[model samples]
Target: MLAARASDDGALADAATGQSEGGVRWAAFRQGLVTNVLNPKSIVFLVALLPQFLTDRSTWADKSVLGAVTVLMVFVWFCAVSLAVGAFQRVFRRPGARRALNIATGLVLIALALVIVLTG
Candidate 1:
């Protein structure tokens, strides 16, 4: 997808950078929602980390409060990131900028793949 977007100068490229005329892309939004919801790493990390802040006598109420706080913190972090990205949406919408970004992202993914292959 990044490779295709890098060379595209049409609707596909535009949509890739959230430049669709009809506004939000529900399909992509749904995909992202599903991916985040089903991410086991987050679940495992929270399960492992949260217990460190509690004791053997910790009540259910205490656990609930801590879980709520963690969720709130994650929500705030995502909101801040979304706002930061939205602020730069105009720059990303530019053809040259989008192309460069897509190429850079593609290179980053390739580098990550190489690292995984070499390490494993």
Candidate 2:
């Protein structure tokens, strides 16, 4: 958002960034950090699952391998998503595109809810 705001030229990006560009970046990081740090499920998973992987001297290597694979997967996923989104961004910005997209998403979610409820 901060990067986009700096490139806004007082256009759409400016509107999205609000009054100050710097504030949004820090706020986003803070929100993510707080949510992650405070999540009990995260704590429980770290305590319960991670310890099993640390059973021996080779644990460090196991953790390193897992972390490396996770980082690589995330990088690959983001790259793919970035390319796909970049390609579709222009289409998304067209008039009434957001409204149509939102309605389509809502319908799909409603349909999924109905299916779940009916199945149960």
Which candidate leads in lDDT?
1
Against the true structure, what is each candidate's TM-score? 0.70, 0.56
Model 2: per-residue lDDT, tens digit, 38-85? 989967876786566565676667888876775576568756976897
Runs with alpha carbons beyond 4 Å of true place in candidate 1 = 5-35
lDDT of 1 at 111: 95
TM-score, prediction 1? 0.70
lDDT of 1 by residue, 35-107 (tens): 8778999889988999999999999999999999998998788779878977997887688887778779899
Model 2: runs farther than 4 Å from truth? 1-12, 16-58
State each model's CA lDDT, in order. 0.78, 0.65
Clashing pairs in 1: none
After TM-score superposition, the amount by which residue 37's alpha carbon in candidate 2 deviates from its true location, in angstroms, is: 9.0
Question: How far off is model 2, as Cα RMSD?
Answer: 8.0
